[model samples]
Target: MQPITPFFMFEGNAEEAMNFYLSIFEGASISHITRYGANEVGKEGSVQQAIFTLNGQTFMCIDSPIKHDFTFTPALSLYITCDTEEEIDRLYGALSIGGAVLMPINAYPFTQKFAWFNDQFGVSWQLNLPGKGEGF
Candidate 1:
């Protein structure tokens, strides 16, 4: 397991968000969902949690309690390193839907390609492609 992995707290949209992520990232897969009621710890029919893997990295997500104040912030951004421009473009486009773009996708001094944006689910991400001075 990755020592430091991201865990997202969704507002009753964990399953939908996980599916959205899986559709965008190649080789992504979601484990069978574990409902909250199944564990006898939550209201019936409520989603508890689910584990998702993308490009061999694991990320866990769960539905936040309705009464809790769980909001995604810019301080917690996910950085995705891409090997090619195509991959960067694909991910950037998919993640930008229904979301705000902090920086439009473009070539940068430090990378062959780069972009930064927050997804619809309020998760921020920085997509980077290795450049001439950087080793992949």
Candidate 2:
């Protein structure tokens, strides 16, 4: 199966935030943090980034540099293709907690069932459940 993962950009506290996430989610594993050296793009010894895996999905995070413009937008949302209605509902509810819902979970013209929301972490997601005529 193909897995869809998201990469988030943090101001400078990526390590702390990622650690906090690992603490909240059971079975979350964080890889060792890597630093930039003279051979890298940024200043030597600067923290490069790390990767965190929750359940089986991987998320990559990095500290945003002064030169990079990092902003979260709806256009960059991560789509979760759910297999069942119950699964979709469960995830939709969990992700919507403490977050704003841009599109309520419901049936749409183009899709049988779909929901769009921005999670508490400022990440956008589009949850979709295929219809009768849909293809995987």
Candidate 3:
């Protein structure tokens, strides 16, 4: 298990958000999901909690039985290191759909390619291609 894992509290869309993330990343998968059973505070079929991986990093989330005014913010984001420009572009395109772009995909002094955006679920992400001879 990872010592540090990101946890999300969704407004009843935990499963949908997990599926969307899995579709965007190449090696993503939902390792486990425990849905709310009968008489639970949340809907019986809703996600009580879920464990998933995206690009090899594990994350967890749950469907909140009570609604909250806040959602994800760019204050904290999933920073993804990519190996190729194609990977960065693909990620940028997918994550940018129906969400805001904090920074456009372009060449930067630190990296040859980069992008920052929030996905439809309001999860922020930064995709960066490392400089040559550097680790990704």
**Best candidate, TM-score-wise?**
3
* lDDT per model vs. reference: 0.83, 0.77, 0.88
Candidate 2 ranges beyond 4 A from true positions: 1-6, 12-28, 34-48, 54-57, 65-70
TM-scores vs. true structure, each candidate: 0.86, 0.66, 0.90
lDDT of 1 at 60: 90
| Highest lDDT against the true fold, candidate | 3
The all-Cα superposition gives candidate 3 an RMSD in Å to the true structure of: 1.8
The per-residue C-alpha lDDT of model 3 at residue 50 equals 95
Residue 18 error, candidate 3, Å: 0.4
Candidate 3 displacement at residue 79 in angstroms: 0.4
How much lDDT does candidate 2 score?
0.77
Assess the local accuracy of residue 9 in candidate 1 as a C-alpha lDDT between 0 and 100. Answer: 85
Clashes of each: 0, 0, 0
Cα error, residue 44 of model 3, in Å, equals 2.0
Tens-place lDDT per residue, model 3, 52-136, is: 9987788999999997888899999988888888888888888789988998889888778888989888999998998887545
